[model samples]
Target: MVRKKGVYGIAIVALICFLLIVFCTKEPDTVRISHNFQAIEFEDVDVIGEDISIDKIIDTQRLRLERKFDVFKFVTNKTFNKLSMLSGGQPLRTIIVTTWRSGSTFLGDVLNSLPGNYYHYEPLLHYGIMQIRGPPHADTAIKTLKNLLNCDYTDLENYLTFGMSHIYLFTHNKRLWTQCEAYPQYCWNATFLNEFCRLFPFQSMKVVRVRLRLIEELLSDKRLNTKVILLVRDPRGTLQSRRHRDWCPGEPDCDRPDLLCADMVSDYSAAIKFNKMYSRRFRTLRYEDLSLSPYKVVQDLFDWIGINVHPEIKEFLDTHTTVNVGGVSSTYRDSKNVPFHWKNDLNYTEIQSIEATCEEAMKLWGYVKTKGPKLRDFNPLTSYTIK
Candidate 1:
């Protein structure tokens, strides 16, 4: 009886070892790939030789598209608990709360430039598969975002499931999206994302969907070690930029000031409340101020958030804020003059419409009206005088 029991115990150990090996080497589920999934692509280049001029993008799109895909298997759960990560003394949770065309993307690129920071660009891009439709979806945005910032990818399975039709969604985190760039299969695998997300020390995500009031939960959540940055822009400039994206909405929402200012007014009120409560955890940035004085404002911003300005951000600011400008969605721009670009484009009539609708926001947020004669000359767009 004793010999038989020993043989049975040895058999059980062998079975357990075999199971572990099989689980480790199993092929990724192919059903994870969607038949209707749209292809996601980003423009990039490869260096062919020692010289920069000879560099060219290795054209792999054809080959990449033609190949069959199997999800990339991910292999680690090396993440520490949020308490442990934060108590060890430095993984700060920073979130950018702003709307599109408000220079949020530009600011996002700036913040993500720092090494050791893992950036989740527009994590709320999954609402209805693009952008958040309205406040009714606030709960969804809030829950999903908190999960993302916490490095919990369980809730993000669908968002990362098919990669992203919106390239900027992940491309902003160059360190991350590269893994999915070649074979989107990697992005579809939640296990891969779960492990990838935990590898970063500083986890940050910028969101345009939810309002400032909605962000209060995150600020109050101690487990997150959270900090919020509210970035507001002059309504005129935001509307003007939205006009460039003619295909996008131009109504009581995106391009229109009525709903836009309503949202801002509510957000500003929350900012005031949050400032009094979580002073260190909450801060606001005006796009006009940052654009007008990139270096000073950014450095002050970094200091406020207890982070040193990365050298990469300086190079980014130099490259993007100068003559190397791009289109409506691109982050590249003449940062100093961008805030006033709308001044040259918007006529008195258009300005009147926005200013009238956003009167409360403009006054409360310190954006001076087009009263002075030099309005056309790009005079001071902001003021210390808050009504």
Candidate 2:
């Protein structure tokens, strides 16, 4: 009985010492920004157009917990954020500035395929929807996009439910809740979801619905810490693809030279203008170049984002790259056939109209006019060479 009593007393004493050490340790009370960009603050006005209360849309519990954690860690550990960067686990927010039928789907797929990465697809779809009280302004879209990059869906929840407002943060094919049902392992674990939320290397958004005029406003905001990949396609190809798919229902006839082609030119001009101002954060990619040399192209893109291609992403591309040639709904074709499909599919007048409308962009992007049914051979076997 005496021995038992002594052992119990020792156990209590050891537990006390452990508790004291944990509470007394003094860590530096400063959390440094992991990256070199400035943090941005959102505007006071409600970004969502709905009349509902903000709390209804926001997951207040999650936001509060995140803010509290950020404050607590900032006060307790100076080295915490630095360690995240050093370990190559720092959050990287990326926005792929693109338009419809411009190969953004494939690129978004590649980005989303990367483990620990998130992809938001066309979050600006709410702009055209009438069910929403008002069209989403550039400022509102930019604000919502930035919030999503940080995993804050506060103002975006209501917008995602209405008319043409189907913004996809993960996959467009599957609803947000059904994502886990389709891919179980990729689903968030309730226990570690918070930790998982904080550990991603990339949070990407691909926008095709927003106006090109918004590029400056969106990219100029340094708080976003976003790299904009201005993706362009040969206007001839873009028009042909759009017409074939008829994806944008509200737009005028795509075949009308003034419609799709003019929009393409405007977007390209915006990209060019912004590239001049924010040369460091802006990059322009052409579908022709990407199709001909996807491996080299994405390698450069991945380098711009400061990450090597994830092996699984590479493998996924290897299989999917050749599966669909024209668009998501189109039939499977040789991967090399993608860039040259315009050669066979588009006739002389159609090509001429697109070329005339997109003359400046074609020249700017180095898309030389070719006049042959014969396609230059491109070997898909050389697809993604991992260095």
Candidate 3:
């Protein structure tokens, strides 16, 4: 009986040891790890171990692992809400917000052309897409961008727009995703969007291209010492240019021209309203001024940004400043010698139609009324073609 009892006790001890081993071997379901300016989240971790310190995993391999984990977190969350929270919320240097087709792209391209400037064209679009589809989509966007540019991130970062450069230019698309009825939830979530914008205010300059409507939001960022460049053009010309783009309304190529027109009008009205509200903040310039006096405008812009034009930049400007009408392949046409094309291109009827369609916008922007013989009728269909 004594021997049997001893054997039973040993068996019980073995069972307890087995259970302990099993418990120790089980992996954690989630682990939150943070490192320099970033936090990594790991889910479904298989190894059950004591919590690891970020300091202990500061090497290259660990950093790569952390990045992978971050990608996973981004996918799961489908938002960049936590990015600002990491690194004690480091602020971004600059944010350049603008409406689409308002020479923002040209400005971005020009800024990026300058050395030592980081100009990201439409980064918010990528960010928005990432927010919608998660990390895989973000990765795909990055990869596609890299491929389209025919350069890797390392090479691209050398220029002023791809990475954390000293000078950053961000051209944010003004159209909120929520406007699309199909994806109301994807519209700019103020919390996340504000957080994203707030992350970059520490820079030396935040040059914002303020359309009339978004000035309020631009003003709300008290941290940002905003320099507003209010860009304006004739509503008729604006619509004409807009219609020429493949993405514009009334384009035969567009799947829904009616919706595009409504959206454009809404956007134009918002711009007009914004301009009225923040007229004092703006250094208003006509699109014609930029075209006719490229050098003067560019020099003035440089002064505003507090950058001395390097000799190389000046030389490039001197060569490229002349107006190259009829697309990029055309020869430089001296603005002084060339007659204004609008006089011939825009008929009386077309002008009146444009005025009628965007009278509020024109009045808000301080456009002067012109006297002319009224033409019989205006047909926008004949004036512009979608490329």
Model 1 vs. true fold: TM? 0.73
Runs in model 3 deviating more than 4 A are 1-100, 124-212, 222-226, 251-282, 323-340, 373-387
Taking the tens digit of each residue's C-alpha lDDT, what string does model 3 give over 1-387? Answer: 999999999999999999999999998555433211001111122222334322322222233434443544312332222222223432222334434444544444334334222233444332321121234444444343332122123323222233123112222221111111112232223333332223321222222222234344444444433445555455555544454555445443222323323434444565455456544443545555666666788778666654445443454445445656555222234543222344446676766666665555455544544566542332222121111
User: What TM-score does each of the candidates earn?
Assistant: 0.73, 0.63, 0.43
Off by over 4 Å in 1: 1-90, 128-135, 161-164, 182-184, 372-374, 378-380, 384-387
Judged by lDDT relative to the true structure, which candidate is superior, 1 or 3?
Answer: 1
**lDDT per residue, candidate 2, 139-258, as tens digits?**
677676666665565456445454223323333422232323322443333322233344444567787766555756667777666788877776667766765654454565334556
Scored by CA lDDT, what does every candidate get? 0.68, 0.55, 0.39
Better of 1 and 2 by TM-score: 1
* Candidate 2 residue pairs in clash (backbone atoms < 3 Å): none
Give candidate 2 misplaced runs (Cα > 4 Å): 1-90, 128-136, 163-199, 246-250, 253-255, 323-327, 330-333, 370-387
Residue-pair clashes per candidate: 0, 0, 13
Candidate 1 C-alpha RMSD relative to the actual structure = 15.9
